[model samples]
Target: VEEAKRAGAKVVVVLATQREADEGRVGRQIADELGVGVVYLHGIQFSGGDEYCEYIKYTLAALVAALEASSGAAGGNGLWPLLILALSIAVVAEAGLLARGWWRGGGRA
Candidate 1:
């Protein structure tokens, strides 16, 4: 892990265990020690299933991103996609909250 960091690598650890995902778990400690990010995934069955395959796919993607980032070249697309996604979810949640409040109070405030 230290060698990887010295090589300008971002270590991403994908942990599929709920127990290890709890606070003060060993997985979190390892990530903290390595200064890496941990991707917590649930329902990751290694017995040849869709969720397992998807986890593998995401892990590969994360590795590629980390390697590509070592070149110090900025990607064309910035945080716009993530910002838009967050905004969309916030709008939907606000609408739901407002609808629920209005429905309960008969259209007031």
Candidate 2:
């Protein structure tokens, strides 16, 4: 993990299961020491091949989201802008709904 990170690789620690007698303490310890993203697959290790594929898909999505969030927190990026836009749209939609409800109630309440 350290070597990979030194070579400019974004490292993410993945644990196959947390059901060990040590309760995955070793994997968690390494991840903590390295300050890397750790994904615990839980019982998926005992699942079929299809579940493994699903795990890959979701893990990739999670990794992308984590990267985006970290980049957004690092500096002035489009993330905050996009978040504000989304919030503004939500507020507008909520206000429209409220106005319609109030109108239906004959301006009461």
Candidate 3:
């Protein structure tokens, strides 16, 4: 985890037990020190195991939100909207061009 964080990857640590969640001593400490995300799924590991899947989804979403917020995207200070709009415009233009070409070809393959 430390090595991955050092390599510029986003790190998320999931604590599987209540004690681990409460303390997460080393994991939480490292996460705090490295500005990473930590999630506590106290019973997912020992319960039905299917709960782990649900918790995994939640954990991933939380991590993404945290990373986005940290990067200023969620704060509206980033270029996210501009980029999305640009991509939308590009897709629309491409679709129009394709439609025009199809019409010119009498809608044939």
Best candidate per TM-score, number?
3
lDDT of 1 by residue, 1-109 (tens): 5775676445444556664546427656656777665555444545565443345455445544554453345665453454455456656666776788899998787
Candidate ranking (TM-score, best to worst): 3, 1, 2
Clash count in backbone of candidate 1: 0
Global CA lDDT computed for model 2: 0.55
For all candidates in order, the CA lDDT equals 0.55, 0.55, 0.58
Q: What tens digits encode model 2's per-residue C-alpha lDDT throughout 42-69?
A: 3453456544434544544555555454
TM-score versus the correct structure, for each prediction: 0.38, 0.38, 0.40
Residue 84 of model 2 has an lDDT of: 56
How big is the positional error of residue 103 in model 2, measured in Å on the Cα after superposition?
56
Name the candidate that leads on lDDT: 3
* RMSD to the hidden true structure, all candidates: 12.3, 12.2, 11.3
Model 1 segments more than 4 A misplaced: 1-22, 32-35, 38-78
Q: State in Å the error of residue 17, model 1.
A: 17
